[model samples]
Target: MKIDQLATRACAPPGLHWPAPAAAAAEPAARQAGAALARQPGQAAEQALQFNRDASLQQVALDYLGRLEERAVGVLQTLAARRSASAESALQGARAGLERTLEQRAAGLGEVLDGQLRAGPATRARVQFEVAGLASLRAVQAAGAETLLFSVGPQAGGPLAVVLDEHLGPARLLRRFNASLGQAGVQVRVEADSRLLFEIDEAAWPALREHLAIRGEGRLFAATGWQVPPLREQSLQAELRQAPAGPVLRALGEQVLERIRAAREYFQQQQSQLRQQLGGETRAAAEKRRVALDFVERLNDAKTTAAGAPSHFQLNARAASVNRAIARSALTRRSVLGLLA
Candidate 1:
């Protein structure tokens, strides 16, 4: 018989006709009841397992965010302390640290998503981190024209001569230098008046200036002496320089602060959503357990009812025992025996 049928019969009105009990009937009913009982707990157990996995991933995300935040804070503190000093090396170190932290944050987000995928479909659907401003920061670091211009170096083999185009604007001129120089550790910039400004390390500037000739259109200007100048100038004026570390450090610090602020806000919102989801899952798991427990109770009652009543011979034996108990009570005059009678 089906579990539902057994349960209904278990709760039936007294005097209702029931099927005679036999091993054949009893065995199937018991097996059906046991199967149903097993299914209930199986569902609850699966839900609990899923909930635990989600909770563990949440902790992993929290730990990753905490470490990222700490690293960002340390960078900010170092920048603040050395803001006034001409600590170029220290400032560069701090900037490098900030860059490393940003890279780590991106990697951490990837790991979090991978973990969610491993966890299951439910977690993947529900959990997501918003990286709003981070992409832009990374883009600036990776592809910003100025950053490219400042970090270029000389090409492989040797210094190559660059022919400047008079028609090219300041931006084009800057790109031209990077294309020729590769990343020669030379910093190039454009002035307000469309003049290209080049700065290289003081110790190395003389050798580079002598070897790397610049060919530009230079027309002859007639003066009182009536002299004719060459069609092109072979040399370009550049500054033998130290990098202006103070302003660069300050700018980097501001960028780092902005990135941290945006990331913190995003993480806070994500954490709040995760907590709310966890709470809902917890309630759902509790309800599932309660449902499983109720099903087990009903299944137990069904099995008991399916056991059926005693035989006619057992009824006769009970009546005979009652008669003996009554006779004994009459002789003993004991209240306990009287109650039994």
Candidate 2:
């Protein structure tokens, strides 16, 4: 058992004290000595009275000593409290002075750092973007840049976004952001939302599709938020295909998190509910890869409708707004991969 547990158990027993035989003997001896001293100068009855008086005096002295000890304790405590208060005041003054100095410095650099300092955990998932070719690109840094959305380069070179170069797989965004956020009370959670976007090179898109060997009928993709200038037109697209959470660890983690947050355990008493869900939910496996399947499929069909060289007006009239989303790249493959890592 642990020592504290043992101590607790020991406390359950009765606590008791008994004077040692020697101590009891000493008390009696003192009483006898008092009696003898009293007898020396008095009659027998008077000596007995004197003995009681002497014993009372001894008790008074002991009581007085106890009062002195109590007073000493009180004095010590008061002195300690005074010292503590003085130290606290000194510290407060020093802190206030430092704050004043910092305020002055901030005023000197007013409006320089107006950027909001908010950072939090983002929901994580892995994205596999095939390298169209090889070239130099910028990677993200913990203390430097927080995110890298997209980049551009020659058509022969691969993505201008950096990965650790040797690593690929589902990695939690939390691992990279632990020190980056740098606050104790600030909380973080990896959340999932409606959609994520990837911006890829238009020229590289055709090459990447072939390299990945995806043979989907038509996939939805998009690129968005164009400010900086680029070599190609302001657009990119991808052929989305069904992909699995690679490796046993990540697959298990995803399943575990879902199950923990599951509203209800459908097959709590029964067997294989989760397993069945993972494998396939009825005819869904046969259905389009996911819910987005229809949007992209319809959008792609709408894009190339009436395959002759058509007028701009006809193309515009036939185009679905949904296809615009698919064509526009919001999240680049490089950026997505970095978040996953």
Candidate 3:
């Protein structure tokens, strides 16, 4: 009999007709054997139904869990994509800001350079004259050499002199020559080795170089036995106060540009790192961004100084470059220390 039928008959009300226990016991052996056989199949059918129900429930639970896991992964991926986008946007903005700042600095530097070039007087020129010595002027004189003559400054009232004479001695000769040279605004100094050096004053340098026109006259110095020593020629020099040329200005600009580019790249890397560490908008992250923005704002403005000379501009550029390095180093130090702490 089916399990449901068996259950229904067992639970019937008392008024139902039924076989007596004595009649069942008195049944023939063949009938008893048939009843035992019928019970075995009914028990197996009930066991099979219970197993199918358990397997179905287990499969349903597995499917439900798999779907839940897939949904969770999808949500996490979406969140990560959003965080990455935000990071990219922030980096781009910072780069744009840095570029703007660099452009402004370059423009300002150019103007200062132009002003420096224009400040000089047309007549002003830079020059240097070097004078060195012979072993002994007395030796040349004792050998009966011809006197050497050289003049400094304009011909009209400039100092002119013959080479050292033996009777005067080096000391006396230097003293006599210095007296007149000093009066003419030219400086003369005797070295440890009795070599003499002459240099014109800055106030009179240009005119002296222009008209003095140092040239050999009959090789007078060579007429001294050992070929009287030759005077070194003077050449134009750039004064410290003079402005640099275009190439120099461009070189300076390149130096500053390189530094600014390095700083920009550094800040960009730092922004990327921050995004990786803190993907979501939180108070701590917001505060850190604010600090970074403050740094950017401070970097936007630069200080420029206008002085009377190009030397001052050089000094200013050096000072500004130093300040930039210090600022960047300080920021890097703070970040590293904060991480370690």
Alpha-carbon deviation at 303 in model 2, angstroms: 99
Off by over 4 Å in 3: 1-128, 132-146, 153-155, 213-341
**Cα distance off (Å), candidate 2, residue 30:** 38
lDDT computed for candidate 3 = 0.40
For candidate 1, the clash count comes to 7
Cα lDDT computed for each candidate against the true fold: 0.43, 0.30, 0.40
Q: State the lDDT of candidate 1 residue by residue for 215-291, as single tens digits.
A: 22222111223222211111101000122444554554455445445544554555466556555755654565456
Which sections of candidate 2 miss by over 4 Å? Answer: 1-42, 84-341
Assess candidate 2 and give its lDDT.
Answer: 0.30
Off by over 4 Å in 1: 1-33, 36-58, 73-86, 111-249, 309-341
Q: Residue-wise lDDT of candidate 2 within 166-242, one digit each (tens)?
A: 23222443333323221211112232531112323223443433432111111111133322321221111011011
- In candidate 1, which residue pairs get closer than 3 Å at backbone N, Cα or C atoms, i.e. clash? 152-183, 152-184, 153-182, 153-183, 153-184, 153-185, 154-184
TM-score winner between candidates 1 and 2 = 1
**What is the C-alpha local distance difference test score of candidate 1?**
0.43
Model 3 lDDT, residue 208, Cα: 58
